[model samples]
Target: MTELQSTAFVSEDKFAVAQVALYILAVLQVVAAVMLATGGAPIPFPQQATAMQRLSGTVNAVVMVLAFAVVYCLLARCLRRPTKLVWRIALGTFLTNFGMVVLTMVAQPGPSPVLTGCLCFAGIVSVLRGCKSVKAYSHS
Candidate 1:
């Protein structure tokens, strides 16, 4: 490979972990959306939940999951040629996900939520570790 291309590849490797995490998050969001649509997702309901309440909860969850999926996909695409702003945004997203996971674990205390929280923590660490490389690439 040409020197320039090789350099680009090396830079890409720096951010690859974050990119993979974003892709995984996007895919998980999509899966959640599908599960919600098919009524297979576990959604909390009040003791006397009416049909309308169940429908409303499912629709809202589906919409939120789909929106987040779109955002994750877009962020992953931006990582192909990450800018400073993209890096900050990605870090912010990872932090936000981690925060939410913490809250979920506190409220629900389940294995599933703990696993999700671990993934979010890993994403945050990956992005932090690649900070210098992303800054260099942005400057270049």
Candidate 2:
């Protein structure tokens, strides 16, 4: 294959990896959201043992699920068309994941804090790689 064709192939592969990571992150977020809403061991630090807490937890859970759905849709689109819009969506996902890590650290200390932090970092790296791939492919 030509150099430009090779670059395009590599870009597609990178986007595939990123899409997989996004799906994994979405699943993780859904799990976390469930735990938050259920008053599980990993409940948020900002939460209290009150009706308000329960309500807030439910809201948080809903938001998490909705966010995951949106990300999944964006990932599908990105896979179909790896363009600027795709990179923007990936960046948004990275930022949102980062925000979740911060919120988790601030709201409560948990056994999985390290894991959560790592996951957020992974998301950031994946996003950066995907963006770079897109840029390289475009230039090629």
Candidate 3:
């Protein structure tokens, strides 16, 4: 492993923004999983919803649980390897969120797809830059 990969000083400070984003993402995942599991409307929605909607909700809950696995994986990696894993996980989250944003935009039209996409894109870039910076910082 490179020097940065072996160091914590660079990873912790540089990854603060990404860490906050990951925390928010993790909470969102947990809420989504619970909402789906309970067969109720999540925070984004207000009503109890129809049978069809509930069925879809159940399906979404399953997917959300799986997505939350990524959060778990990142957490696990933080214990052993931050430099190598953070950027990859961020990229994965960004791609998955990006697709959801597009679907939400085209299918629902009530939310801001552009804004969501832009934010996700920015988060992904931040994470990548942070990772690169950490690596470079260690070398320097």
TM-score of every candidate relative to the true structure:
0.78, 0.57, 0.56
Q: Weakest 10 consecutive residues, lDDT, candidate 3?
A: 75-84
Q: Candidate 3 — which residues are off by over 4 angstroms?
A: 1-12, 41-81, 111-119, 137-140
Residue 15's lDDT within candidate 1 is 69
Return the lDDT, model 3, position 20.
Answer: 56
The global C-alpha lDDT for each of the candidates, from Candidate 1 onward, is 0.85, 0.67, 0.63
lDDT of 3 by residue, 30-75 (tens): 7657766775544344477777876775777668685775765465
State model 3's lDDT: 0.63
Q: Candidate 1 versus the native: TM-score?
A: 0.78
Say which prediction, candidate 1 or candidate 2, comes out ahead on lDDT.
1
Deviation in Å, model 3, residue 49 alpha carbon = 18
TM-score of 3: 0.56
Give the per-residue lDDT digits (tens) of candidate 1, residues 15-80.
677778888888889988999889778898988999999999899999999999999989988877
Question: Which stretches in model 2 have alpha-carbon errors above 4 Å?
Answer: 1-12, 36-64, 76-80, 136-140
How many clashes in each candidate? 0, 0, 0
By lDDT, who's the top model here?
A: 1
Which pairs of residues collide in candidate 1?
A: none
